[model samples]
Target: MPGIGPSIAAHLDEIFKTGKSRHFEAVMKGLPKAMFDLMEIPGIGAKRAYRLTKELKIGSVAELEKAVKEGRIAKLEGFGEESQAEILKSIEDTKAKSKEKRHLLPYAEDIAHEIIEWMKREKLVARVDPLGSLRRKASTVGDIDLSAATKNPAKVIEHFTKYPNKKRVLEKGTRTASITLPSGVQVDLMVETPDAYGALLQHFTGSKHHNIALRNYALKKGLSLSDYGIKKKGTEDYLKFKDEESFYRFIGMDYIPPELREDTGEIEAAIDHKLPKLVELEDIKADLQIHSSFDIETSHDLGESSMEEIIQKASNLGYEYIAFTEHNPSRSKHNDQQIIDILKRKREVVDKINYELQNRSAHLRETSARHSEKIDQINYSLINMNKKNIQKARPQATGALATVGRVFNSLEIDIMPDGRLPVPEDGMKTLDFALISIHGSFRLSKDKMTERVLKAFDHPKVKIFAHPTGRKLGHREGVELDWPKIFDFCKKNNKWLEINADPMRLDLPDVLVREAVKLGVKLTLGTDSHHKDSMENMNYGVSVARRGWAGKDNIVNTRSLVEFLELLKG
Candidate 1:
């Protein structure tokens, strides 16, 4: 307690004075509190808010709006037309009441998939499909829209209304119903006959702009489009399809995936049949970042599952490799030597598993070869005994046996406020891989923050920048930096950026991902998972990559363990 310091003592003293932090109040005096509130908008961070207040004389949302409308904000440095538009949109979104009701993509998808599976099990529907932004894999969804093809609409509607999780029924009808789930998520269901399901699916699973563009395209083709079907311009006859593929084929275009149906040249790409092969969940061969109990007691530590459990889970997922990038112990109570010992133990476990796996594989191969040689001897003897018996004596070789996955010892090292790594270079050299990250000190200026990150990239042992932007959905904006410069540095250094797939922190958001891809910056998809079930969130990262038009080659973990190691060496 002797070294408790003035700040802590002041905080304790102020607890009795006003039951709050006097330190925080003093800090708040440096800038208008309203500017802090303005920073809550999606596109505005602390730096931008400070700039708006000091440079533009805007201290509140209203003043920001006024500045935007008067065309004054666009004249400021770094405030272009696009920035102004985004700020205005963010301001509007901040003020909008319904914006708070939107759910994160993974949460919405889970609920939607559960309802679809439940309805399928109940036998009340032949097919059920979630539509709208949820199906499009948007980062957040407003409402869950579903379309069902069923012979009995009334029964399906009744069952939906009576579903166990339903908090309330907004409306009920024979063919349609809306219900609010327990989590305050609203779901709307439309039941149609099998003949019209495709049309409904295509119509409802849309970004409005995409649909309008499709309609215009149809008109040019002398066809009329609707939720019912495609109809000839001067006739009542309509073309119906059983699936989206045929529906798109009818329009003389290739099928566009829901994720790419954003009216962002996807329609034109479909017509040209030139869409890039999007990366898939199966294309991912490993998870590059994960935490275990070894990572406990650190900031943002998700230390639930043990290292063995994580390895088992990765093996079960059929992953060829996984890196246990535990939090570096430099920031914790452990000394460097203790951390090194722990890592040594982890490596021993991994080595034992690998040794056993190799031995088993070798034994299987030897047994297979011995059997094959025996079969060959039998065939030879049969041929000598009688030519007709050779076919019976011959035996085919069994397929190669499966092997256990490889586990690597890695660490998620912190980039300190001054751009130095928390772990020493000696400690870092022992890691199979190092994922450098920013844990705090998010208020650095853009230039300073960019320099800090670029310095971290200069570390010879650092292989990846984990959750590079550090943004958390709906909570905080990431540190401001010149991302184009960062991307170029990464490309030149052969360093990787992580598409962290945690629902709250899908860092390297899609737009940045597209930019990174264009810069030839290699990407690694990490669930940043702390538990077994969270490993499945890898698909979220894959979704982000797909939205950015990244192919399998753009990702690093798609390679086998040997290939990945070789690439790391380069």
Candidate 2:
């Protein structure tokens, strides 16, 4: 946003509004999708990638590497053997660097899904599961690992080799196999009998430190651990477990959740039966951050879907409520009075929609009760026989207490450089609550940033701090802040922190979430969704919460409307 000029902004606005821009079309005239990926290679620019792809049909780095090895690039115009050698060096450098980097959790999950779903179709495979950091739901993962349960290990291995998206089969054996995806990420698979599957999963799923700690704990009991099973120190015989619960039970501990298997004192907690009931996706009842197409003339991007459309999507997801926390009206363009007027207008619209949803749900419930009563009065025996059908005849309501669409007219207002909120007191009062965030001046010293955030929290309506760390997973680091002080302030002042569910910013990262949970701080989950469909990202937030060992009690969004309003009052 800082580097963008007026012309660039105009171009973007045009594309957003109409999906077409003459200048953009001219710039992208003859390029194929592959050229974009090719440009990502270390030394290749757009012009070079375009020429190479068009001239030699080298659509990927792998293909380009092949051409370079074949001496084909040296023969091309303006490229001699020396230039070819330089390109080869760059390619090698890139390959080595990529291998050291980890893929994002969603990307790894998708790759695992392809493998597990494919293996499930094999007749010999009874159960398949992901293993390693993937099972722990880490933010990023290295190469994928999975395991399958089957008596016919050889057949399962054979079936794995025939996977459709596999670029190459690295290895194949009677009980194991490995493959490389076309994307160059490797996938490893293991096969085990049903009786031994639990041992395999537990062995592979825990982190290296977790495994060592668990093994050492078992060694104290004169037991040795292995993928096959646990065995006595002096005995060759191994005792098999049919499931993970049994595996942990035999070791005299409760089953440690996969997310908590990070050697983070989880083993000790499990032994004492003190492990928290980790939060699940089902515990989520609201998506606190949403943007609807109710325009208030903000400088930032507007929502692409209407509030009605978002409510309908939330209904399908079974949410009790959602907050439309759009960016506050552009400060430069609107007067204080204008901003207040716009916010008041938006609140009225939310109230009108809530009225309709409440009335509709009530009418349906009343009608359902009447129908059930008539069925009973008509014939007692028939009513007994058709009770389930009578309940089915009634339309199902989306909310927990016979209501839905309890919209929160919230604003994601920016925390100004000097620690002031952009919105005036009157405009702020219109919001059910305000969520403050720092969008710029990320270079502030730790004390300044801390003071800046604390000043924003002084406002009574500012109930949550959105994307507190402001980190973009692979692109940029977050601003400097005194997190201990920040967490302490929130805990004492009854302010909530946000876990932004956007893939780019799972902010208030897992480590911080864990700290917040430990310090008695409450956190909320929001998709930061610009469109209705992005609401589904709430699951990723729940994943972060669970990884932090948060229970349902720690997440504010898990609260119903009544309970959430009570917190706001406090």
Model 2: per-residue Cα lDDT over 197-278, one tens digit each: 9999999997889999999999999999999999988999999987899999998899998998888899999999999999
Best-fitting candidate, scored by TM-score: 2
Give the alpha carbon lDDT tens digit for every residue of 394-433 in model 1: 3443323433357777788888888988775566767777
Clashes of 1: 0
Candidate 1: regions farther than 4 A off: 1-100, 122-124, 295-302, 332-357, 364-401
List lDDT for all candidates, in order: 0.82, 0.87
Supply the global lDDT for candidate 2. Answer: 0.87
* Top lDDT prediction, candidate number: 2
lDDT of 2 at 47: 84
